[model samples]
Target: MTDLQFQCTGVRPEPFGAGPTLLFGLRIEEADHQPVHAIALRCQIRIEPARRQYEPEEVGMLGDLFGEPDRWSSTLKPLQFAHASITVPGFTGTTHVDLPVPCTYDTEVASASYFRALSRGEVPLLLLFSGTVFTGRDGFRAEPIPWHKETSFLMPVDVWRSMIEQYFPHTGWLRIRQDVLEALRRYRSARALPSWEQVFEELLATADAKGGD
Candidate 1:
């Protein structure tokens, strides 16, 4: 079995008041060059002020298009799983579609781990687990894809650094611990966290500046 591969084609950073947010656009491809029957996509965003989690409002427009409660679970199956077919546009071969995989976690433990890593001045990397895609009737008798568990999209440490440098050079780099400290400071100050849109503006401004040079 071959592993699934993801490529980061573009990284966009937008500003939110005092800081910025990162958005990554990705492309998924099969390793064997064989046509894929379907694809499963999942993403995770890790940040602090541990009290804050992904809110209903946070998903924004994507929520409207994809259905709410993006989180995966044993009880809720993906819409793709319900439908047996996916249409890939412009592709001559089989049409590949996307399935939303369910994710499970111990929120307390996960949050603790995130803070510990950040406290160490490390860039926290969230694991996006996409279960193996199957192809067959009833969505139950399908075979496992090669890259199912091993394949994942990594938000590389370098990419984060590049974003900070290109879009937020003024803010400077801090240890994960420092980041946590800052989050605490902001929280204590009663300042609202910046929205993703604000971060986008900052990223655009930086890109525009560089383009002129």
Candidate 2:
């Protein structure tokens, strides 16, 4: 059996990724001076909403996710952020690796929505690690890394914001049902709306007029 320790040092956005991606810096250490051949690491990251305070505007935005601030004591639970995997190469005492975490801008996702609601602050995260560890100096031996092996990291909100800004600029993502999308497409075509923004503006104007009436 091997005793292992994990730590999350920092995070940064990866620019050349296919989509939005974040690279988390992780440091792994073996308790004994034993040689480690490699480790197939599986990491589950979670957002601890209750660990930090929220702003007034952010509270309002988060109502959909965690309900009102008054009931947040029970509702502000952990949200699943991402599942990342990596293979740590051989090391004797300590080793460092970059855990690449893929991200989305879709606000429909609980973690993404929670992240978007924050104005300025660090997002508390818990990284749960598991999987197989290969060791033994003479011959290779495989062992299971306990699920209890975990670490916590506070990621700055600006890191997320800057990543999104780099990819989407001032845009946000929305998910809609196929039927609803068809209806919107028809409405746009009928009104000769050149852009989706114009289509939304036209719909908003119509809704406002009806409300006034």
Checking candidate 2 for backbone clashes, the offending pairs are none
Any runs in candidate 1 off by more than 4 Å, and if so which?
Answer: 13-22, 43-126, 134-141, 145-213
lDDT of 1 by residue, 6-92 (tens): 544444444432443455444555555544455444443333221223334433422332344543223122121111112223222
lDDT of each: 0.38, 0.94
**TM-scores across all candidates?**
0.29, 0.97
10 residues in a row with least lDDT, candidate 1 = 77-86
- TM-score of predicted structure 2: 0.97
